[model samples]
Target: MSYTKTQTNPTPFPLVKVGMGHLKIATAGSVDDGKSTLIGRLLYDTKSLTTDKLKAIEEKSKQRGFDYLDFSLATDGLIAEREQGITIDVAHIYFSTPAKSFIIADSPGHVEYTRNMVTGASNAQASIILVDARNGVIEQTYRHFFINNLLRIKEVIVAVNKMDLVNFSEEKFQTIKNEINYLATKSDFEAQKITFIPISALNGDNVVEKSTKMSWYQGETLLDYLENIDTTLTNDSANARFPIQTVIRPKTAEYHDFRAYAGKIYGGDFSVGDPVLVLPSLTKSTIKNIYFFDQEFDTALSGSSVSITLTNDVNVSRGDMIVKIDEIPTIAKELEATICWMDKEPLQNAQKYYLKHGVNDVQAKITHLSTILKTDFSGVEENTTALTLNQIGDIQIKVSKPLFFDTYKKHKYNGAFILINPKTNNTVGVGFIKSPL
Candidate 1:
C-alpha cells in the first residue's frame, strides 16, 4: 500500500502516546499465503524499511530471478526459512506512521508450528488472516481462524489476497466471502467482528490505498481500518487483579518504616482509600498509597507497575493476590480448561506436571482427558486418551493448592496457565480455564 504524495488525509489521525499509542497485530495463514509479503508491503508503504534492508530484499529477489521485488524476502529472516521457503519462527516487523506504531507478528504457517502461532499471537489485540484467492477458505484457513477465535481476538481483518491472479474478479471474492461466512456458522464460539478486504500485496493494490483495478470494494484500506479500529478494550476482565510479586522494605536510616507491595496491576484501576482484600488470608485493608519510583499517585490503572502500601500492617507475601472486596475471584483446587499441547510428549491421564499460573507455581495432576477439539472448530471427538503435539483438547486438572482465578472467558490473564513437565522442565501445554470443577 503506497500513499501517493497527492492523496493525504485532511483530518489526520491522532498521534500515538508513549504507552497507549501503539497497536500489536498478528498475521497468520497457511504456507505461501503472503503473510510475509503483506508485512513487507506495509513496511514499505509506511517508509519503515531501511535502505540497507530494502536493498537486501532487492538483491535477494534478483538472485531468485524474480521480475518483481519479492516482499516475502523482507520477513523470512531465518536461514532455514530462506532455504525451505517457509516461516519457522515468529518474526516481528515494526513500522510506524505519524499517528501510531504497529508491531506485526509474522507467525509460522505450518501445522507443526501451531504452538509458535499460539504463543506469538496470544497477546496481540488484533489479527489479520490471509486467504489465497485461489485456494479460498481451506483447512489451514479454518485452523488459523479457529485459533484466533480461541485467543479471543476482538478484531479480525480477512485479507483476500492475490486478486491479480484471479483477474480481480468480484465474483471470486464474493464466493470466498460466502464460504467463510458459512464456515463461521459451524462453530459454537462467537465469531469476532470480521471485515473482508481484497488486495494484491505484490502489486501494492488496496494495501495503503484503494486499488483502481478493483473499484468494487467500498471499504477503507487495510491501514485506514487499523488506524480507526477500537483497541481500548480487550479480552481481559475489567476487575482489578494485583498479584503480589514481591515486598519492598527500606532498611536505610534516612526514614525507616517503609513497606510496599510491588506488582503490575491487571484489569480495572486502584485508587487510594479503595477497599481491598488480600487473598488466602482474606484480610481487609484500605489502599494507603500508590508509588512509582519516588513519585506517588492518587490512583493506578491496569498495566501499571507500581508499589502499593496499605493502611494497616497487613501480612501479605509473594504469590498472594490483592483485589477489590466485591471483585474477589473464585478460589478452588480443581478446574476444567481447554488445553493446547505444545510438547512432543503426549499428555496422558494422571500425569503429574508443574503448573505455572502468573507469579505462582504449584503441582498439578491431570485427572482426566475429556474430548479432542477439532482444529476446524467442528464438535469434539470423544474417547480421546491423549493430547498430542499441536492438538487442542479439554481436561480436568487438580492443583496442589487453591488458586484465585476466573474463567478464561471472563479474565484472560488470571484464567490461563502453563503445564511444565516435571522431568524435562519444558512447557508442555497451555490451559484456558473454563470453570472451577
Candidate 2:
C-alpha cells in the first residue's frame, strides 16, 4: 500500500493541532492473526524499539530456530502465550514519530479472551480489525466487529494480513474487503470509516513500507495512514465536564488562601468565569480561577488535569462534578444499563453489591433483569434471571443514593461504571448506563 497528510485541522495553540497529534489504537482479530507481528513491525520500522529490545528479539528468534527474525517474540509476554504461540492478554506498546506518538494495545484473539479485548479497546479512538487473508472471515470476526461497533470506535482499519501466503493477489484483497463491507453494513455502528490494506505481517510488506510486488495497489502504507490520521475527527470536543477529585487547599505561608477543586477535565473546555453547577447537590458556582499544576491558567481543555476555585463555597467536596449548569446530566437513584458479566458466577437478581461510578462509589442492588444479548445476532432474550460470565445483558439497578450520569452513547466517562463484590472487593461486572430514565 504509501500515506501523506490528507487534512489538517487548525488549532489556536500550535501544540494542539489535530493531524500532528498522538493517537491511541487497539488491534483485534481471531486466533493467530499476526497482531503481535504487526506491532513489532511498527516498532522496528519506526526505529522506536530500543537496541537492547531489538537484540533480545533477534536472539530469541535464533533460539527458536527461526531463519528470519520472529517479530511476534517482541510482544508475546506471558509464558503460556509464548508456549501456545498466541496472545492471551493485552500488551501495550508505545512508539512515536516526529508527527505523532502512538500507543497500540495488542489484544488477545481467542474467544475466551473477549473481555480482555474490550478492556483494551474501551479507551481507544480507533481500532484495527485484522482478518487472515487465507481464511477471509469467520464467526469470531463477527463478534469482534460487533464489539467494535458497540464501543463506537470511529475508525477501523481492516488489515487483510498474510497476503504473501496468497501470492499478494489483488483479487484476494478485494474479496476480503467486500466481505468486511457486507459485515459492516449489517452492524448498528455509525458507519465508521473503514480502510482495507493488504499486508504480510511475517514478511513486513505494506506495513511500514510500500510493497514492490503489489504494483496494482496505489494507496498509503499502514503506518502512513495511521500517522496522518486527523485525530480531531474522532474527538468529542464539545461537552464540558469536570469531576472533582479533591478539594485542593495547600496550607502554606504564601498559598494559605488557595482553595482549589482538583480534577481532570473529562470533556469540554472551561473558561475563567463560566457558570458551573456542583452535582449531587445541584449548588451553582462560577469559576474564579483555573490553575494547571503550579501555573495559573485562564482555561483548561479536555483531558487536562487542573484545579478550579468556585465563587460560592457551597459545600463541594470530593466526588462532586462541576459542569455547565444547563448541561448537567440526569441524577437518579434507579438506572438501566447494559452490563458485561465479568465473574465466574452468574449475576443474580435481588443481589446487593457496590456500584463504582467514576470516583463516587455506592451500594446498589439488582432490581430487575431485563434481557440477555445474543452476540451472534443483534437481539435480546428478555426476562433473564441471571447473567453468566461473558454474557452481555440489560439490567435495572437501584442505588442507595442518586448518581450523576449520562447515557453511554452521550458521554462515555459518565455513562460507564463497574459493579464490585463488596465482600471480596472484586470487579464482577462492567456496565454502560442507559439514558433518560
Q: TM-score for every candidate vs. truth?
A: 0.95, 0.92
Write candidate 2's Cα lDDT for 1-437 as tens digits.
12222224322122324534778999998877888888888877766677899999999999989999888888889999889898888889877765677778888888777678788888888899899989888777777777787677888898999999999999999988887788777776664788888888887788888888788889878998897788777855546888888888879999987789989887688988899889888888899989887688888888888989888877888888889988888899998998888788789999999999888888999988979987666578987788998788888899998888888777778888999998888898888888535
Candidate 2: Cα lDDT at 89 = 83
The sequence of per-residue lDDT tens digits that candidate 1 reaches over residues 20-94 is 667899899888878888888987877677889999999989999999998888889889889998889988887
Q: Which stretches of candidate 1 lie over 4 Å from their true place?
A: 1-17, 188-191, 235-237
Candidate 2: lDDT of 433? 89
Model 2 misplaced stretches (Cα beyond 4 Å) = 1-20
| Highest lDDT against the true fold, candidate | 1
TM-score of 1: 0.95
